[model samples]
Target chain A: MVTEEEIESVSKLVRIKVADHREHIEKVRDMINFFEMLDSAGVEDDELVMDDVPVSRLREDAHESFGGLSGYVREYRDGYVRVPKMD
Target chain B: MNHSSIIRASALEYVRGVTSGEFTAEEFLSETLSRIEEAEARYNAYLHVEDGQKLLARAREIDRGIKSGQKVGLLAGMPVSIKDNICMRGSRTTCGSRMLEGFVAPYDATAVSRLNAEGGIIVAKANMDEFAMGLTTEFSAYGPSRNPWNTGYVPGGSSGGSAVAAAAFECVASLGSDTGGSVRNPASFCSVVGYKPTYGLVSRHGLVSYANSIEQIGPIARTVSDAALVLGVIAGRDEHDDTTADATPATDYLEGIEGGVEGMRVGIVDEMTEGADPEVARAAERAAGNLEAAGASCERVSLDMVGYSVPSYYTITAAEAASNLARYDNLRYGYDLPLDGYEFNSYVAEARGRFGPEVTRRMILGGYVSSAGHAGRYYLKALKVRAKLTREVADAFASSYDILMAPTVPILPFRIGEKTDDPVSLFMVDLNTVTANLTRRPAVSVPYAVSAGGLPIGIQMMADSMQDRTLLRAARALEMRRPPLPEVPD
Candidate 1:
């Protein structure tokens, strides 16, 4: 059985902070239960092969100038894009 | 072709009427606007209708050009509703999501710009599922778009509003984004002609990304010729979208309108015959018979990997959606939460709160599918299966079949609120139509049957990748014998 702590850890890893939510735990339990049922029904890892399509990230060396100004910075200057100032 | 059931009028007819000085462009726009005003309340198809004054001004400009013997597009002065996901400069492109409730696009989608270049008036933005996420428009931040045929029933979605508007003649034609049957399923349910061009055939620039690889902007029209005409305008290479393949030669798609289908090999899928509503299956069979009578040979063909299409479609769509929607964290754009009492991670939480149940369910499912432990098990496996499915379709088309035929949706339009609570059931609603999306093939939904209640049922026909012209050619043949579109009395 997967514990709430384990589920929270997984959720946090995915950037979804749901540790304090009661409904989140229930939903996770449902998912785990579904998987467990599949396991009990003799679904095996051998039957499911993973696809290895590489996650192609933009190359670091390919730095194209953003017209000498980022859209984000432009928005900040225009008071549209907001940010926190140093206290 | 009376007021009701005049859904299949040829665009050529409209052109001839304008050119012959029978009805002015402003007259046509007024009639269309009145029709839209009459239908909008019942169908809830449009997000916002363009100002009648502005539409009249544009139409009058086109009319003046025509009177002066200047060049005009084939669909000049024709009003077209765009799906909300596609950008229209200065129009609110909410993508049916609350996060983008008032977000006006600064620039137009490539398709919108092209349509404008062809003198097509941007009529309005149609409603859709938030981010084009679900088969039913129930996932929309706005309420569900009701079916034009039966107000109590759902107009199939995520392009439901577009399909409804086209079917009801609220506009001459509309643009819809097809991601795993978004356009086709709604077209099927609404009993209109919807075409998804071969993947990347239409540029995706400025279309709000859902599943980047599978989603395509396509045309939904009352007739095949209208779809063909719209496709001609929008289907071309663009500088912004890199994925567009070698440009399919632009042709006057309406030129061969009278061409009879002789010696053409039409394939009917055995897979689509099973688990389908008897009426839908029978409709497909009837369509096949019509093709035979029209001088085309129809044969049953088996696509081996088609049975696995549903799972493969769900996996890939969900995974891509997770990544695409990750940017909506209340940071750069979209709805943001109050800064007071909010933690750093609460932005995501707030964004999640804005997501509908269907959106949340898909996010969770997609997130889980792409998780570290399950990535190899679900996401990757689905891609391999998808590749195999694509190959199966490729091999079949490479063989004797020029096109494959089936019912677009296995079932007819169900009552609104019927399947909303069950996510799995709603997902299964588009089971029959998603295969074309998975395989990156072109497909269309043409009304093949009407129920006793006068609702429209659709028959889907698909062709090989980049063979969009051929599919539209075949659909034009079917359209001649098909039933009239369902519309309200004038």
Candidate 2:
């Protein structure tokens, strides 16, 4: 049920630059069609299960500095992670 | 100890051998390391094995600990393999993806920390599907892990390598993460025991996220007692992962494992075995009959919601993967790529292309299903199905069933490359295993029978949440009654 346009849009949305998303449209459609069986799942009145934790159970909102974390950055200088140009 | 005893011994036997001076830990590990090299040549089960010298040094220390009569630890000197996604401090945890190939974990996962604390030797990091996105190990960026039972056939995955290593005796036992049958699927194919604990029973702090809500770190071992041994070490509360259930630390899983299934109510899930391969369906029926003979009452039970479980599982996992994987923008840790002239959008888009085809498709589907325009029909409805499914399983347990049983997978292992192109066919492999994940229950796969072609089949048993001990005892009971299983062919 998915079109090539929708496939391209989703690829872009996920930050995956599939230059030819048309090539994948058929397989993606097949997967979606498989997933569409949920439409007939007979769960119309069921509420989604949420793992709700009480505020008391939540850990104290204290932030502890994790040493050596910056070292994991691929490109790091002067306590900052380097990235490609924003624009 | 002879080479056969050292290589093929169960985890407990290895511990007993080492502690009772039947052999030294150094001797056991040396033999295991040598066998690992041979097994990897034949099956490609390991992603990485630690340097022999380093591994031996640890084993020697354990030997000294035992000699000096110091309090060594519970595991003594048994070797265990970890699925690659579970972080071990300073180990290269690739997660079977090119994206993190060079990423050395900075700190120990709670489970790994506990394993080390208990004197377990991490012999190797087992291979898995990339980001744990596939049912089979074929999606690994590196080559797939072949089944030890039949080299031409696949070891079911994403924990294929864990099961293969355990089944082939590369390690005495191994740890695998079960998101949707990753552990049990391969264990079934490899003829080993795989146990997925109730959600939150095992800490998820060290595991790379696929679907955070449903996945758990579990053990794959040749025997149910060995799996219980490892599970006892890793299953407990941790300050690191708040999602951990309120349970005693290092709870004894084997204390009552021989309690037997006498007078227990067993439900054989009908939907899980309908249309299964005749051999597999017959195996489930035989398993039920065996349990009946062992004094557990068995009957056919219908689970209507299981029909919708696979699609719902895929939908929810896809969405979560998209969100979880958004962290890999290449601004941080990843493989080397030049960053000259390109802007942020272009840089990240190109960087993210390193993902495997299955991961890419899930990301796309994840984005589409979670999008505002389609959420009502796809993402939210999938959640409803999950809730409904959970309720159905819980009701079955509450009313009449002390445990539920089914064939771990609906079919026997096929040769690799046979079902790679068929996504739906692959999804069905998780048919019986996903209900445990979705409903937050504990499930175990016990190797039951081998097909005429020599493919291994496993019987799956599930129990209500927090009833892990009951599940283990039931699995043990079945393990005791099953016909003898043949050795994995060399």
Maximum-DockQ candidate: 2
The C-alpha local distance difference test score for the whole of candidate 2 amounts to: 0.89
CAPRI grade of model 2: medium
Inter-residue clash pairs, candidate 2: none
Q: What TM-score, over all chains together, does every model reach? A: 0.88, 0.97
User: What's the chain B TM-score of candidate 1?
Assistant: 0.96
Runs in model 2 deviating more than 4 A are A19-23, A61-66, B1-3, B248-250
lDDT at residue B307 of model 2 (Cα atoms): 93
Per-residue lDDT value at B245 in model 2: 87
Q: In candidate 1, how many clashes are counted?
A: 1
* Model 2: per-residue Cα lDDT at residue B309: 93
**Residue B133 of model 2: what lDDT?**
86
